[model samples]
Target chain A: MRHSTFFWFFLPTGLAMLLFIAFPIVSVISQSVFTPHEAVFVESENCGPFGCTTETTIDQDATAALREAKPLGQFVGLQIYLDRGHLATSEVAAAWRSTDSMGAFFKTINNLPFYRAMGFTLTYTFTVTPLLIILGFAIAVAVNSLHRHLKGLVIFFSLLPMIVTPLIGSLILFWMVDSRGVLGNFLQWMADDPDLSLKASTGLTWIMLIVYGVWHSAPFAFVVFYAGLQTLPQDTLESSRIDGATRWQQIRYVVIPHIMPLVTFVALIQIMDNFRVLEPIIGFNAEAHARSLSWIILNDLNGETQLLSSAATTSVLTILGVSILLSPVLVRTWRDFNSKA
Target chain B: MASQLNKKPLALSLFSTGFIVIWLILAAFPFIWTLWGSFKVELDFFSKADWTNALTGARTTVEYGSPFTGAGYHGAWVQEEFWRSVINTAIVCFFTVTISLTLGTLGGYALSRSGFKYVFWLLIAALIFRAMPPITLVSGYLLQFFNWNVWGILPTTIIVLVAINQPFTLWMLHSFFQKIPKELDESAIVDGCTRFQAFRYVIIPVMWPGVITTGLFSFLLAYNDFAVTTLLLAEENRTMVPAIAAFMGTTQTEGNVMFAVAAVVSATAPLFVLVMFFQRQIVSGLTAGAVKG
Candidate 1:
């Protein structure tokens, strides 16, 4: 295709992405450095019955005018990034000096919003990715062994957990695991503890979210690996069987090696996804116990207080996290493209 | 492939079958259990007295004189006017899918046909954009949209979704376009046709299978979206997912959690139907990238 034709063809999508995706990223970074204007205050004198006092009252008109004049607000550079809500540089230093043990130091750091969210997001991403891969691969192999007709049925049911909206999926589980709900009741019976609520403990909340994450994503892995299984080389499998290789041995040697690329593909995509981990927090109402980076951004953007600057800062930090996770995938894609070319 | 040599030992076969059954239940039981529980009253649905009440709807029978009740659904769809949100969702999904596919097909085809290094960079840029959590983008949009006085409206959300949908759509369709023999379009170009005309006359005719698959995914993204819709929309303009989320906040405090349950089930019903019809396309679309890699 000629450059002119290509330009016309790509213009719409390119423009959409440039405006919405690229522009927003620039906007977020700029917003991170700038904050909403502070309320302009003026001192007023009140004199009544031989008593006089001066009061500092917010001048609404001036404040509104200032905000209206410069919507991006005053530029604070990296001030917001280092504040108590985010990086908390001074707070971390204080904790580092005061704590006598590593556990205490971590406990202090975990109280900071940014570190807390990062802790959960990274833990969730790392734990869920490997676990879901194993579960998905196991399901794929098991389904592959089933009768051909049963495969479709199994797949249809398997896709439900993933296909449903994340919030809705988590809400369903949350309701089931509420203290009085079926699963919660069963748990109390099994453990002989009537007061064992999953929501009350930080460790349990993390476990619940991770479990939900694995349930939500394993099907994606299963589908891809299942597709990989379809084109497996029968001759190699037959030879392995003739050599008296057990089922586990064949999978370890032939099947796993065949699907290794798919596994990598699933892992990279899941890592990018699991890093966000927003909806389940909202659904479970587990914000008090666990928060992800995306959730922090959402919380800042939500409700009576817009907190745009704070949210924008978290967003910039989250974008940094995403890029760090995405670098490996980008490098691999580059290598693949170069080889193909 | 299922011959004597491939036959599993009895214990192994039983274990695998058992595992499959356990996995299936894990995958599908929550929806089943939610659907069943949604018809009961809050007391029965979350019964402290007896867990079996949820299954049997014991308290539901005493209150409504029936084992099952539609009160939760009625409260959600009728009293709460969830139908408005449903209509909003329909409009959003319709426009998002149509516009996304139109722009995506053109861009994807161009990228596939071009030999320039810039095409590679564009795709890499798109992958980076795709990886960024959309909430980050929403924070960027909040300030701008509020400034432009365009927030909390259907068109604004639709355009944003279409934009967010572009990266994945372009990647998927680009790969799909690559599989279409280049000669198909080139032959048309040789016959006194402009590039656009070749695409319009020849390429469009044979692109439906790929387009449909891409369209299914685009629909799914728009439909299942919670992040963009919840943040971008006003209360009155909410979609089903956000509406159900809203229900949780209000109803949980009111002791009307059953309403949220019914709303969740109602929201999930269409997805169930969609999967029933489009399972094949969804699977193929999902594996398309992995296959290429």
Candidate 2:
């Protein structure tokens, strides 16, 4: 009777999940694999900036010959044009005729800047998540030690960045970093040199971007850690202190282990969020140095004739990559649930 | 007693105060700068050395010597664009918070008490949605909506903001609901209450903190959002962050002063009120989902 009641209760949520979330992802992955390359219609009527229009008709003989050579339904190739209604070369057309294999298609995408962007994203996520976790834990511990009245003030103030828009944060950073701004000027004075400029390309751009991200995200980490701290059984902690455990020892043995689940949670989220870091990139124009996976997806999607397939492929890759990396967390979560059940 | 002696209260208090002061200063630098920058005039804003210049500093006879030389508080406050941005933000926040809370609370309750065999799947879905970068979804939503042919479509700006905020709120609220015991629902039902009635009278009251925290965070999400608003919103409907971006993007030098002022006002005002009202709940809610049994 209990089993029947439980089954009836869960039916709606299960259906909703299958329909809304799982369906979109499955469809996206299927589209990535089975999607045929159709000729993109470069609409002549409203083409912006780039005014190139050309149609190359493949003759019956050419189609037959190309199909015989590649044994594919269609040829995948770039059609370059100098102007509206003009084809650049028949050679360009021939190249398209020969390239029909999935291997070539995948190779083309992998060779593009997308892979580099993915690398940057991975690095960003790995770097930021750990740093944010450590910083957050430290801040949370510090805040937890404060008196009741001052604790509120400390937490509220630390969380200020989480409230400000990332774009605004970038703007503030931009002003400060600009050669003429106060920060730049201060650095110049501190160096005792009038000629030193802070705006020039250096590793500093990446540093600044990371700093901005840390400032914005640490509040979230701090708040979560603070909450975790609150939930630690007071008796356990008091017992640890009674055993003559030092503060560091208590934190290491008692608090860290207790909060490991929360730390893992924060780490998982930070990985995803930092991997998709786009606003600060756009706002700061740090894209040249720091192109994250999301930036690559955006750039690909924004092509004159949208490369939805490529974008979809990249999105699938990201989802898969992140899932693989987070498998340990997922396994732990699953095991915990199974044990509980 | 001997062990307790080592945990000196005064030393701990001093240590905590020192640490907090440093953290607060680091965290509050951008906000304080925004506040200060908002008050300064254009020339004083851009003049590299003029950061130290007081509001009453020598008004040079040269035109554009100082932003304060010409504009007063009234003049600054009367800008049409500034006020419009505030209204636009409020509208966005109101809709975002309302929709998120309504759907999130219902969905969260369903997840908590429904004994749904697929509750794990729902939880995973919510996490995926929450985990996917806002930018990735924003790009897809933009392309899909830009070419949308449906008549009477809501503005892309509003839709994008709502979509970006929904996943986060849903995840947070779902966790909140899950934290509430199922026995509450069973007891309420045993007392002749319907599901909706129990939810309304019992669950919601107990879960108000979760709701408030989620709602307030949604408001902050909407208010702080820029990439979507900038990319999706048309010129007339742009929110405060995008407007600040525009002001920064433009050629005008004086606009930065205005941008800084607006930035401070827009980001701080709502957040201040939220933190004041729901500090405990907000802190607890943020951490609760992070570490679960």
For residue B138, what is the lDDT in candidate 1?
92
Task: Name model 1 segments beyond 4 Å from true.
Answer: A44-69
Flag clash pairs in model 2.
Answer: A10-B116, A53-A84, A53-A85, B41-B67, B42-B67
DockQ of each candidate relative to the true complex: 0.86, 0.39
> Candidate 1, TM-score vs. the true structure?
0.97
Q: How well is candidate 1 docked (DockQ)?
A: 0.86
lDDT to native, each model: 0.94, 0.64
User: Which residue ranges in model 2 land beyond 4 Å of their true spot?
Assistant: A1-112, A193-195, A232-244, A299-310, B2-4, B8-17, B54-80, B142-147, B150-166, B179-181, B187-193, B200-206, B251-257, B260-264
- Per-candidate TM equals 0.97, 0.78
Q: Candidate 2 on B1-293: residue-level lDDT in tens?
A: 64454365777768877877888988887667655555556544445665565233332224446434334333333553556666777787787677657766776666666554577766765666666555444434433354464211324455555555655666787778777888887799889987777778988779877788788777777787755665556667766776666655552465535544455455566676777777777776676566653
CA shift at A126, candidate 1, in angstroms?
Answer: 0.6
lDDT of 2 at A17: 44
